[model samples]
Target chain A: MSNITSQRSAPFVVAQIRQDFPILKLKVNDKPLIYLDNAASSQMPQQVIQRLVDYQTNEHANINRGVHYLSETATLRFEEARGKVQRFINAAETREIIFTSGCTESINLVMHGYGRKFIQAGDEIILTVLEHHSNIVPWQMLAEEKGAIIRVVPINDAGELLIDEYQKLFNPRTKFVAISHVSNSLGTVNPIREMIKFAHGHKVPVLVDGAQAVPHMSVDVQDLDCDFYAFSGHKLGGPTGIGILYGKASLLEAMQPFKGGGDMIAVVSFAKTTYNHIPHKFEAGTPPIAAAIGLGAAIDYLLQIGMVAIAEHEHQLLEYATAQITKLAGVTIIGRAKNKVAVISFVVADIHPHDVGTLLNLDGIAVRTGHHCTQPLMHRLGLSATSRASFAMYNTFAEVDALVAGIVAVQQVFAGSM
Target chain B: MSNYKDLYQEVILDHNKKPRNYGQIEKATHQAAGHNPLCGDHLQIALELNQDLICAIGFSGESCAICKASASMMTVAVKNKTRADAEALIQEFLALAKGQLNAIDLIQIGRLAVFAGISQLPTRVKCAILPWHTLHAALNSGAETSTEAEHDPMRTTIGGA
Candidate 1:
């Protein structure tokens, strides 16, 4: 129960929760800010910001190195943060959660740590058209190095993944599968649970790219039964440069250490080095300690409001935004999947997305324009790029109205050009 | 929204709708493609050079309105001009786009001055300068050029090109 749904059942409320994000009050170009680019990066709440300030003010220390009191406090808080992440995603163990720079590095970790060790030549790695470049490129690099083939799962015209086709892709050659829990560009909520089960049947492990899914809905990695789960913090209203990789403990133990450095080794000498445990073995350097703590605070903030509440509000916004945009002439909604999050990708006829983005900025309505790093999906949809408006828990119905008004103003500016 | 009109203006939109010299120039002496990787804006500039003069110029590709309009105006402005004059114009237009233009440079930009507002939109400076980069690349016989400021060969070899 996030704040929105909590309003229906209990004392917590969405309006009070909205005040937690100070950027909501910002005025861009003399107009009230209407931020719909949450899918790219959501606005950080003051709670997370204050947590960073407090941590740096009181407990700033390099973790696990010193015998000092501050080092012990920082180390305790950092491990507590890891525990928070473990519980947030319903991870099986604390050691299963490895912190990286972001979701990209998390996937790359698997590509290096797991894929390199086990995957051999002639193996086929299954991917979907809905994957971001972050998910695709690392696998491509791994495939190139290992002489593996990448098999793709296509999407229908409505931008929904073809589940039947995905099932058909598996054979003895299929070694692994990586699919997005949600499509960033189209807002399509993929059936990852079923897909993971299908992969498991083939004895192939599945890695769900939860970068776009975790913020909008409750994610239970154990329930999905995915071998690995990855997500970014910034997209979850936390600080940038921090993300999580949830791997099955056994799988993590079996894989090679992705990087070797301080705090990641049990014993280190020039002669031979024995690596540390699961999480630390992958975290090579002095990780983003502050960001991981902020992400913990962000998780607290979301849990306080409740995810069900957040998803409910986002769905309402999606419905209103979709209905309004559909009524406009020459404006096409790109993704109309039966199941989707609050993202809306659309194109204004004969006008490039850059033009639309520029005009919307003048109206203080910020939406992401271009391929959204899912160029292959854009190509599959027969578009070079489309403007996207994504919602977060803090977003309001008025903000959706502002977005519509902004689009109308953009249309008026280029009225007869088409 | 008026801020957009200042950037998009009536003429820029018209040029985008029906770009002048909007095709490959047959028997072109030199040609080069330009790309703004940030937004996937791409276009090629082709010119038929007769000794030192650009006899005919044309451009073709897929890009945003700003890039299409900039390319359209560039072909119109540089067609039939001497090689030196065209190169000078390219520098002036690029300077104008980056908002580094002096009053003299602004005047030199002429009708192309409509794109001057791009400097305020840092994300769009490349869109306005892409055509100029491609034109410069075409004259110098480069295979391609990017809108990235560091890749400007003219900045290092202005007179040589």
Candidate 2:
């Protein structure tokens, strides 16, 4: 609480948070690292790091297997972490949460398992132009394999999905509607709840890629009634190589297991192999135990600060950055959606995004440049790529000011030469 | 913010703004396109060779400052040099950009030294190397190669020669 207040007052709270991540303290060209590429991955907090260290040191046992005390203790902690994630996203049951390597694996799990079992030839999978390649490529592969067609919901010049166009893309053949809750490239907070409900009306299953959204807002999978919700831990102040895939229990019971292995099955006889129930059925082999514990710690950290407060703080930062950067000449923000998370993608007129990113780095300000793993969106926007500044709870308004100053420097450097 | 000034030197920005030989070359004998799909950087390097010595070199595409400037400087550096010299320069420049070498004495190659700062950014190494990678590919393909560079390592695997 006090930490959050102190964090709000400073423009460079990320530098403080950077100290919590031991790697962030490392000098890059004798300059303090200003990591603004939260969308790619976030710096892990000290709590999360400690949690991983403690888990491996003290609770280093395989879960749900051995009858020994260590095994039982490990199982309890793992399941407890699952429960925390269930609560974090407000999912109906712990069984709905399946841990994976990351968001890409989670999306692949859904696309390969559920998509293979349900989708038929000629069926349409409705996606948006604004999805990250992780969300789009798996479905594209599934569609190609299943003889299904993909129908994309177009976005406006502002990068907001055209709701009316999305509605039109819907039909009986639209078996699944997979969309990102927030655009990784554009930072548009899509009306996913409404979109999910509309898809439900047509009896279409909807999978929400909450990788970007879950870190920024309060996500209630049950309330949204989305068929599936997926996110990565690294984006939310947790360790890498860990993610959550939340499916409705009913759907989980129906879908086939994505990978076959020891933990995912009940009995493995030569004659017949019985699979495990719900969550375990999808979690094959030895899971990322330390990373899961780190995610739990990250969730605990966020809960202690409160998601509402974090969201409010981020919204303020986004507003400040947007207002300031928009004032710069030749700067055109890609997405101007009414509702959005903390990402802002823009291009400074003749200056390329990579150039903007490079120049900004000199100011100890980090940002993502180029298409942001959203090449289709770049094609839709009719641009090569845009520089993106994504915010997290630790990010501050002063960092936003630094970003503006960096852009101004870029303008001067290029303008003088021109 | 303190001393990273070398990373964004004035010369790099100058070249980025007013790029040299930025358009397509007419009747290019060899050409290759390179794309950094990660950053959406697309560059087409065109070479006009008269026998062994390079007669003209041109490029056309959109990319970041490091890549565009590198490409701009590369075109100027390779012009009138032997094909083998151009290939060797590409290797030297690649090594220099990676900071494997302290300094590269390529006659008049200047400001390219600024990209030495890019090696400090592990993620951006691809953005800096894209044009050179493309030039390498175009030279290897042996096709009448036009408008296509070798396959980008960032996008595709480079197969056996």
Off by over 4 Å in 2: A1-32, A416-418, B1-10, B104-118, B136-161
DockQ values, each candidate: 0.48, 0.50
Query: Which candidate ranks first by TM-score, i.e. highest?
Result: 1
TM-score for all predictions?
0.95, 0.89
lDDT of model 2 at position A212: 93
lDDT of 1 at B22: 95
What is candidate 1's lDDT per residue for A257-356, written digit by digit as tens?
A: 8887888899988899999987888888788999999999998888877778788888988999999999888899999998999999999988899899
Per-residue C-alpha lDDT of model 1 across residues B20-90, encoded as one tens digit per residue: 99997778999999877668889988899999899999999998888898889889999889999998998
Q: Over the stretch A198-261, how does candidate 2's per-residue lDDT look in tens digits?
A: 9998999999999999888778887899999999999999889999999999988999899999
Taking every candidate in turn, the Cα RMSD to the unseen true structure, in Å, is 3.3, 4.4
What is the Cα-based lDDT of residue A135 in candidate 2? 87
- Interface RMSD of the candidates, in order: 2.4, 2.8
